[model samples]
Target: MESLKNNFATKTAILVDGGFYRRRAQAVFGDQTAEERAAELANYCMRHLNFHGESSNLYRIFYYDCAPSSKRVYHPFLKKQVDLGKSDLFEWTTLFFNELKKKRKFALRLGKLAEEQAHYTLRPQIVKKLCNGSIQFSDLQEDDFCLQIDQKGVDMKIGLDIASMAYKHQVDQIVLISGDSDFVSAAKLAQREGIDFVLDPLGAPIKPDLFEHIDGLRTCNKAYTAHTQK
Candidate 1:
């Protein structure tokens, strides 16, 4: 085990929902390399030690995400049929996962993506124009169609690990970095097992049901770029 620098008496495990963090980080940090993001992730989790002026030993970090889909689809922006397998987004995601794999005490849990054809919603602007007689439905282009890709198994893996860790006594505290309320049951189970359950929503407003289940609501208050400011 790495030396426990914090003086707290608990062992803490940080579980991260990779998809949520990526979206939030992109909104806040603009754009960053995968290595930089992974480093920020570790640093963010470690900052939990400052809560209540107490410190805890870092047990591990569990990151859950789905790999990018390789399916071919109509590109709305490019206005053509495209292969996502050859897309820049796919390349970047691959690099991101590779960088995450190199972080110490970090475990990556991958899930599957299911792509299906569904009725696509027109952009709000187009819809408003049509409704107000400014445009017709015939104005909609085929490029406006989209295929939805749903993530599978990511949440299940997180919950399963929570149960496993609680039952096995792997850690005394669990810090989950997710906004999904689907974890309420799992959080309850962990809390019932005498684990200090902390939720780090990264400053996102959480549902009341989720807030009631956690022992603490903490967030990484600094922007991602703040790390470089000093």
Candidate 2:
């Protein structure tokens, strides 16, 4: 316990999912103390991690969210308008049967997160193909379309920042504050190239696969220290 507690003070950068993270934070501390909690989460990482090495620049935490647009913001309500009384709208998810036909984990996470909030499903429409029945997956386009945000553009920017740092060898090691498995590929790439990777997911301990693969995995708990930031 003593050694574990001490590991938090280190050179670390946190990768956070803006929607899930903030919502989780809010769930933990309520709306009034949200910013305080965010700031405290940063401080908590610094205090606990033993980041005493060559990399002077620690990322602290990189928060990610999609870029926000009014269209994206209103996408849910508009989708609800379209899905009225429709049973095959893929049940609880905003994803149409056509949409889920072409799957991406990122899309699934975002769509499920959206449905969790009950804002109506925001799955994109596919152009039903005439040739032997296939759906053209515009949402799965690699060019970052569904990335338009309601929480706004936090996640994409966070991802780009991580990529930039990894490309530039920015930090000695990174301590991601998220558990969104979307980052697993990036983490693996970092480790394959000999960069140290770590995780400090806020509400729980480091994930088991991450623990096995990452060089360092620190556990973060809102309860250990007061969620109230000084």
If scored against the real structure, what TM-score would every candidate get?
A: 0.82, 0.48
For candidate 2, give the lDDT of residue 88.
Answer: 30
Q: What's the count of clashing pairs in each model shown? A: 0, 24
Clashes of 1: 0
In TM-score terms, candidate 2 sits at 0.48
Per-residue lDDT of model 1, residues 74-124, tens digit only: 665556667888967788889889888888888999998865652235667
The list of candidate 2 runs beyond 4 A from truth reads: 1-11, 33-35, 48-60, 67-160, 205-208, 222-230
Best prediction by lDDT: 1
Number of the top-ranking candidate, with TM-score as the measure:
1
- Candidate 1 residue 66 Cα shift, in angstroms, is 0.7
